[model samples]
Target chain A: MAGAIAGALAVFFVLSVYLLPQSYLGSIHPTRPGPIVTDVKLSQTQVVLGESFSLQVSATNSGEHADMQILSIAFPSLSSTDGIVDVQKHDFRQTPLFIKKDRAIGAGYTAQRLVPAQYPSIEASNRPWNSGETFSIELSIKPQTEGEFVIFVKAVGLPHNGDQAHWPSNGTIDHQDEFVSVYSVNVTKA
Target chain B: MNYQRGSLARMQESRRLVIGYTLVSAGILLAASGGTWDVTNHLLNKPETFFAPPHAVLYTGVASALAGMALVVSASRAAGQFDWSAKFLIAGVALLLSAGPVDFVWHSTFGLDGLLSPPHSVLVSGMVTSSIAAIIGLVRASKVLPAALIVVAILPVWISAAGAVHMFSLPFSNTAYFNFNPHPIAGAIVATLGFPLITAAISHTSSELTGRKFGILSATAAIFLFINTFTSIIPNEALVSTIPFYIATVIPFVVADAILARWRSPKSLYMAGAIVGITFFMLYYPLITHTYNKVMDNKTVWGSLTAIIYFELMGPLYPVLLAPAAAMGILGAMIGQGMVRRAILAGLR
Candidate 1:
């Protein structure tokens, strides 16, 4: 009897170990993969100091579902680690939108955006892109002073399910560093 | 021999019951307190800054102890009455099993906003179910089913522990898919909560084995081996990645076993203590300084220090520690048998 009990226990132990990796029974939704950044470009390779130039960034929907309300754009500051390019300052110029609101782009779709030249800093942001949607953003820059300079553009996507109303979640929550770098520009005296 | 029935007999019986209740209560309380403290400390440091007050700990400690004692008392009285309540036992088990998913949903949806969240539902449930089952078995003086329940509770833990070990050697190229990107507190709670229940269950069932003496030794040795396996993998410096393994498996099992053996009527507390004491001094004490140096000088490996220590102490090449740990376990069992024999003799005298 004791031997039978021990043997039974041994078998149960073996079986239990085998079953540990099985996913919990009732997970609500399949985990969706996040968006991917593909390519980025600036309107001009080099710009004159105090003159405005545009930055164009492209992203593709690398994930399965159409992500609505995913914030993908970042605005550059002079204080940013990436050196600033001078452009005319406009207070109310809306930044380019990376993801369309209330729109579900089918899998494998691409989207693009062009920020008007009136906006002062390079805009950096990211949003959820459907599997094939290639999206881009263009930022207008004005260089205050120029030596050889590089401007950095960063785009991040917040998950649709994430709590955006909360303080820290409203900003780039994941800190996914999908970045683009522009070539060195020399502002020559006009 | 009409079993004497009177106030004197009842008083003696009640005294025995009180002592038994006290021992079990103390054991469960200490285990719960240590487990919760270790888990919460890790939790507060994580990105989730949820804090359970010290008073909460006291409440849970006292509550669990009282609950455990009540079950034991009921079981004892039921045994005396020859009326075993399987419904009560089943209800307790059901309660334990329900806790895991309930808490998972509550936490994942509500986050730390769900304060006073019970310890991981699975662990609490497993512990309570197993404890209740043990009490039932003691009442009926039927050993087999309680042993079976214990074995059932231990299965997932061992499997998870082994899987966690396998994760280290997995090539980093697979990190994209395999990496959980887990929050630190979630990882810590999983580890700290699971392992103690596994160890305690094993300790409880050791008594039911055919060669009770040998069974105790084997269980103790197995626990040590599991701990060695854990310490080998846990990175020295704390990282959220390693927290899952340390909290879920290592701390709970080692700490619980240490406390349970110390305070309970363990078959061989002294022997268990000696092995644990030596293992700590030789393996962990020296490794602490090594870990500190690694953390201060090389931050990258600091989180990996637990794994490094585990490999150093128990990897294939080092038989010295493993050999003694196993030997001491066997010797402890023999000593335990002698102690039981002596007690029986003293009673006869």
Candidate 2:
């Protein structure tokens, strides 16, 4: 009887492990309400003063069942700092660029210069980003000072299913924005 | 004691008991191998699916262990003989079985977990408990079991106990849902104190049970080194530089075994235990470096680069740790001797 009970448990365990949904057992950071940044990579974290570095990042629609659009990827800190760094080049073509100045942002962020590094291509920018598809952004930056600096990267987009008129703004360099990632760059005097 | 020589012999020779013990031993060894492989796979950034081969092997061993425990319990009851080892085996099996479901729920809720999460702790704790059961079981039946089997039993006890210590000290237990990571100083204290204690305790038990046998401790230590080297060190190209250093660690184990065999006094036991205990840091090698990393503020990404990080940390860390670790090992040996004496008084042998 003890053997039989153990055998039954073994069968149950095997079934649970094999048949469970991938959403339940496989991955973390499940589908959210907006497009979320998935991965961020820097060409170099430490660069000589006045030298250039690049930031490569990707975002995906994290809506559980709804498709979202890739509106823009912004660096909200570069423009605010006095002379620490400057955005040199970006890969976004025929997209609008704007400076959001003196705007009180999300939680714990004092109002500073908010700069949109790149907006999505206009034709498909408003269309659904689609599930499993990613929006990649690359920016070349030059450090103007010889100290460590944090660049706050955020994605802005909205689920197509939502009826809100303007793009639902999710980009904020603050603690409340879970979709934001902070990248550090250390500049050395050479 | 109620057990006569004839009765003890009959118990050892019982066919069901023999089969039960063999199955349990094989099952645990299989699980230990799978656990090691699983950690390696995780390090390699392989897919974290239940269908992964390592998990299959580990769970298969768990099933086999469950079946073996059931058989052993039934046979012991039928013979009207129930000992502490059998009880420990049953409790260990229960904990092992329960850990599966608990771990599943934890993963489902928290997504990915680290080394020291609640469920993983329970699982390693189960492994330690069952290993102790096997060691005591084989030690008591030493007259009938071969020396090879006893050595095999000791291997799991050592690996599993090391795993249990790593669970608290590896500095990787925090997850999205919960922060299970212990403080760095706390982890350092645990590893510094825990590793030697485990090593010396196991050495003392093996020495006393084998009648201060000359080769048993060395044999078990050799097998452990070979297995860890094959699974952990040999696989990563970066760890190649540390191979000779890892191999050199077995000298103390050999020396300890020789000392215990030739000189059977308490003083020699303490000396042997300290020698065996000092080897704990080297015995665990690259993985043990994580605890040291925590205290020294060395950040690691824990992939191929981990080898370079461990090598750098070892130079500064080993000198500070050796003496305290040896002191703890002596204490462990005393505790282990006390355990053997208690078991003898209870007629386990």
Among all candidates shown, the one with the greatest DockQ: 1
lDDT of 1 by residue, B65-142 (tens): 446446556645644742232344345445544654676675566553211234343445444543444343333332
Candidate 1 chain B weakest ten by summed lDDT: B165-174
Cα RMSDs of all predictions? 16.4, 17.6
TM-score of chain A taken by itself, candidate 2:
0.50
Where is model 2 more than 4 Å wrong at Cα?
A: A1-190, B1-13
Cα TM-score per model: 0.32, 0.64
Candidate 1 lDDT score at position B18: 40
Model 1 segments beyond 4 Å from truth?
Answer: A1-74, A78-190, B1-91, B97-105, B108-211, B219-269, B277-306, B309-349
**Candidate 1's residue-wise lDDT over A1-190, tens digit each?**
3354345434432332222112111112322434444665566766676676665555544554332213233333233313443323322123343332223322111122222221123333322233455555555656676665554343333232222211122222211222333344565555
Best by the lDDT measure: 2
Task: Give the Cα-based TM-score of candidate 1 against the true structure.
Answer: 0.32
B1-349 per-residue lDDT for model 2 (tens digits): 4569768756655666656766677677667767876776665444457878878878887887787788778878877888788899988878888888998898888888887777887788788788778666655544455677767776777778877887778777766678878898998889889999988987777777667778888787888888888777765554655565676666677777777787778887788777777677667777776677767855543343454455556556767887998899999989888887776655543
CAPRI quality band, candidate 1? incorrect
Against the true two-chain complex, what DockQ does each candidate achieve? 0.05, 0.02
